[model samples]
Target: MIRFIITRLLNGVVLLFAVATIAFFLLYWGAGDIARQILGASASQETVDLKAEQLGLNEPVFSRYGEWLSNAIHGDLGASWFTNQPVTEAITSRMGVTLSIVIGTVILTAIVATILGVSAARYGGWRDRTLQVVSILGLAIPGFLIAIFLVRIFAIELGWLNATGYIDFTDSFTGWLKSVTLPIIALSIGAMAAVAQQVRGAVKDAMRQDWVRTLRSRGISENRVVYKHVLRNASGPALAILALQFVGLLGGAVIVEKVFAIPGIGQISVTATTQGDLPIVMGIVVFTAALVVVINLSIDLLLGFVNPKVRLS
Candidate 1:
């Protein structure tokens, strides 16, 4: 298990390094005259030259990469060129909002999907048909549209939640819940539908196994046989599917944040990219990569716990 963990960590570190390297090169080479962009087209060549020189844009790309990478290793992701704010500070400040929505979505999706899926599989008539129709519609609709509908109905019509903006959980836990609830629901609908189908299929397969009959023959309660034995056996696949949904939720949250006016990592990322704030953008890239790595490792650990055979790989 230790060896498996070490391997995953190393892979994650390597992936981060690769992502950072690629982003740095692409941003520099592809983005034309970033210093000029910051100063605007009206700025004189001499001023641009001076600004570039100040930013070490005068240096070779490889040389700049070396220095940046070295500083990054030492936890010095340079300050934003425009605002002089540290990149890490900028990302960390907004990270919580994004995380709150994403985490809530994950939890909601998993629990509800599990119940719907198990019921659909075990009872199979209207429940199965309903699951199929809902999953299809959920997948067919875009998340942002769903978010818009939620805001319109719940926030505006029902007056249940604020239409826009975020509240810190520290200020009021209830306020925070209200702020994130619609966004979480919007992001989770599709994920829950997808995961529910996966769980349904897996559970159905598990039920077909001969051991299910053996368990019932041994006088085990049907609920225990299904919940304890069948669900546990089927869970490996369902967990894997759930883990994959994190990536989708992270991405979907970005669009949802914009619609809901929530301050989050996605907002900063879009801002930095448009403004050519390389330091903050690069910081986001590395930080986001690291987050993805951590989530993947956690899922791997969970998978190993659920199905010990995973660790053997």
Candidate 2:
């Protein structure tokens, strides 16, 4: 297990480096003159040239990339070209908001999806059909549309939540919940639907396995056999699917944050990208990649723990 973990972590580091390299070059070469964009069309040619020189845009792309990569390795992400703020500071400040939504939504998704899935599999009639239809609808509907509908019903019509605002958890827990509830729901529904269907299939397959029948033959209670043996064996695939959805939720948060006016990494990422702020944009990209790598590695480790066969690979 320790060897497996170390191997995964090493791979994650290499993956992050590749992501950083690709992101830096793409933004540097593809996005035309940052200095000109910052100064605008009205700025004189000489002024733009001087500004570019100041930003070291005059330096070779490889040279600048080397400096950025070296500094990043030493924990200096560099100051934003546009805001002049440290990239790390800007991202860390908004991390809380994004983390809150992502974590809350993941937990909610797992609980709801698991229950609905297991129930549908156990019953296997009208209840299962209803859940399947709902899951299909969830897959069909985009998250942004769900956000808009939620805002209209829960915020505007019912007045149960604020249509657009974020409350710091440090200020008040209740206020924070009120602020984030709609966004979480909007994000969770799609993930829940996907996981539920996958889980339902996994559970049904596990129950049909010879091992389950053998356990039942040993005089094990039906509930004990299903919960302890069937679900446990079935959980591996469901967990893998859930981990992927959690990553997807991070991307979806970008739209949800924009709709709700929440100041999160996603919102700032859009701002930085639009302004051609290389340092900040790179920071966001690398951070997002790191998040994905870590989540996947954690899931791998968890699966290895739950099913020893995974560690062999």
- Can you write out model 2's per-residue Cα lDDT over 1-313, one digit (the tens) per residue? 6787798899999999999999899988766788999999999999999999999898899999999989999999999887799999999999789999999999999899999999999889998999999999998999999999999999999999989989999999989999999999999999999999988999999898898889989999998987777887888989999999988888899999999999998899889888888899889888888999999988887787776656665
Flag clash pairs in model 1.
none
lDDT by residue (173-205, candidate 1, tens digit) is 989989999999999999999999999999999
lDDT of 1 at 190: 97
State candidate 2's TM-score: 0.96
Structure candidate 2, residue pairs in collision:
none
Q: Would you give me the overall lDDT of model 1?
A: 0.91
